[model samples]
Target: MYLVYYSVEISNLSENKQLSCFMHLQVPQTPTVIPQELNSATSTSIAVYWAVNDGDAIDCFQVYCMEELQASKDAGALVEEYRVTVKESHCILEDLEPDRCYSVWVMAVNGTGCSLPSEKAIFKTAPAIPTINAEDCTVCWDTATVRWHTSSASAESFTLEYCRQHSPEGEGLRSFAGIKRPELKVSLEPNVNYFFYLRTVNPFGTSEQSEAALISTKGTRFHLLSDTAHPALQISSKATVIHLPEKTKFTGFPSVLGELLPARGCHYWEIIVSACRSYRIGICYEAISQSSVLGLSDTSWCMRCCPTQTSSLYRFLHTGVMSDVCVTEHPARIGILLDYSGGRLLFFNAERGLVLFSIRHKFTDAAHPAFALEKAGVLTLRTGMELPEFVKHS
Candidate 1:
């Protein structure tokens, strides 16, 4: 019966209604960030913005991020962080990490809490695209080393690029650019076949190429085949030159052939004679016989030249037998190595390193590279070379 005791002082009316609900619950007022949307960043994503400052006591928004540790001796033990939570005021964040440098901030949140962080900002991202370990490349016969990789630490430079896998689209492409190491050596041309790739620059941009890698360089590449020449021989629209004009007369065997010979390795080439009286240079068996005569056939092998007003008479034919070699000097650049699985076949005089003849035989078939001019001269076909440390130590 003391309901009247409810003269209620219920603790001063619950302390005046908890001080009027803490004066309408405050706690949101520090947002301002903004300064990293350089067109929405990218390479993994970033974006972020701010400015709100008390938008009706917020109620959402957090962000945060960090990173920015490009090894200042592993800055503060590799700073990391990251967070998110949005509801607007901008936010993209995403898997990020490419060419990094971040920092960011923001905050806001509400049910009466969070709101003090907002000044940091800074940013970078955008520089991932490397990949090109093309099985770690290596080559050699003219050089090649290549190699690449990048999840991005903001690659500050690197370009590479290449071409020659049938060049002609931007013709022999080639590029190098700043390059800050991810490996590179390049020079290549012996046996060519290239195609490489890899881009990734920075200062926040340039990356979108990597993923090509083909590489071949090692030795052996062919050229002359003007429809298997001999209509008085003339091939040279890039068939690597060969001419015979002094009144072309060939009842059938002024020969010419090339473009095959790589069933194995070790090859080398060159030829450049102009001022001739007889010529032969050799390798054959593409089913020889167009009225046959290069080295008198057994499927060919040669080295003839014959000019003697007192200066050039070398021989070494095959099958029609002939041997006579004993020069001391008389070479207009001839070189030709071919080791096809080691059955050897040499003949250099290439600028007087002198050695003019060698043969061994054992090849079973598929071989080509033959030529014969007999009179009017001019043969010129150099081909990707590389195999001379004196022909690999003789």
Candidate 2:
């Protein structure tokens, strides 16, 4: 054939393609500027952004990410490597560990080869969800102290969320944010069941909500049942107080029963008596008739106060039998303590810290707090009270 291949010249090929033909194609220039949007990062993913050099030809981009080593010497043991290929200038590295430091770099790639990796971009993913330390959480009548723990060393802050357990979702849900420590104290309603959870936050974003925990605040909470009250008894709108008008034609005892009862655990409440001449405050079986005088039936026990001009006379009564109790002063405030498991009932002069009377009886039936006003007076009920230390010891 006469050596015709010697004279042919190809000028249409680009410099890079020519270099590739000669096996000397230059790699794309390394990405010079990589800007990290910290807010775009999440617990398990990170977004990386870089700029491609305008003068170099690029086909695809390669992203390399790895967990940063705490010690340089042990880099090979603990490091986890991740790589991805993309046609765009940005990529989201997925399935990364939460709350961990990572080093990332980008390389412009072409048919020839990949460029050197860009300067390492170091960042930390958002913190992981926190766990509520149930054993460390404590609740009282009106407040709760909650504690939590996290595995994330990068946790910047914490948030606590709570709501009444019975309330609808998002209703009455409250949050405490920007808590630097893993603990928080929240004010809450007494004797209410509440649901709680925790979340961790970093500069990147907030973690997912932790598993929820349920707790009930301590103390007894109840109100007078209007349906169980005598017709003449004037019950307050909130049903926390009852009044017997000085003039009324009702014939039966002005009595009422509390709306709730404690079948277990020790419970306490208070009653404010406003200048009453005669009244009966006690606990009785819920089946007790509203017309029956409190303390006069076998199902009830009470402390009856009948004050004379000279002094206040008190008596402990049950099943129509009564015993006189000596008192040094009139009591305007009375405290009632009932320990169902212990089978103990006690009445206290709340202001004087004097034990007015006590009875030990195995409660065979569900008991409701009962009140009766023999004469015109106001009786305000106060529930959700913590048991006194003296009562606990007694």
Number of the top lDDT candidate: 2
Total backbone clashes of model 2? 0
lDDT value for candidate 1? Answer: 0.74
Best by TM-score: 2
Q: If scored against the real structure, what TM-score would every candidate get?
A: 0.33, 0.50
Clashes of each: 1, 0
Off-target runs (Cα >4 Å) in candidate 2 are 1-27, 33-35, 55-57, 71-78, 169-172, 218-394
Clashing pairs in 2: none
Q: Taking the tens digit of each residue's C-alpha lDDT, what string does model 1 give over 1-394?
A: 0011112233566555532221355677788887764435656777777888534557788888887776554545856698978888887787876767788888887776777888898887778777885545545356667877787765777888888878876576679998898888777776777888888777655666877887777544467778878788888776778888997666866778876664456668888885665888888877777678888767888888787786677788888766877564567788888776688888988786667677877777667878888888788877655566777777
Tell me how far the alpha carbon of residue 196 in candidate 2 is from the true structure, in angstroms, after superposition: 1.5
lDDT of 2 by residue, 1-394 (tens): 0111123335677754432222244678889546566567788888888887787768998888988876535645856589999998888888988877788888888766778888988877888888985545544445666888899887889989988888976687689889999888777776678889888998887788899977667666666789988888899987788898887777877888885564666668899985566899999987877667888889989989878777888888998767887565788899998888788999998887778888999887767888988888899988655566777677
Q: Which stretches of candidate 1 lie over 4 Å from their true place?
A: 1-67, 73-101, 109-114, 118-194, 198-207, 211-266, 269-336, 339-344, 350-355, 363-394
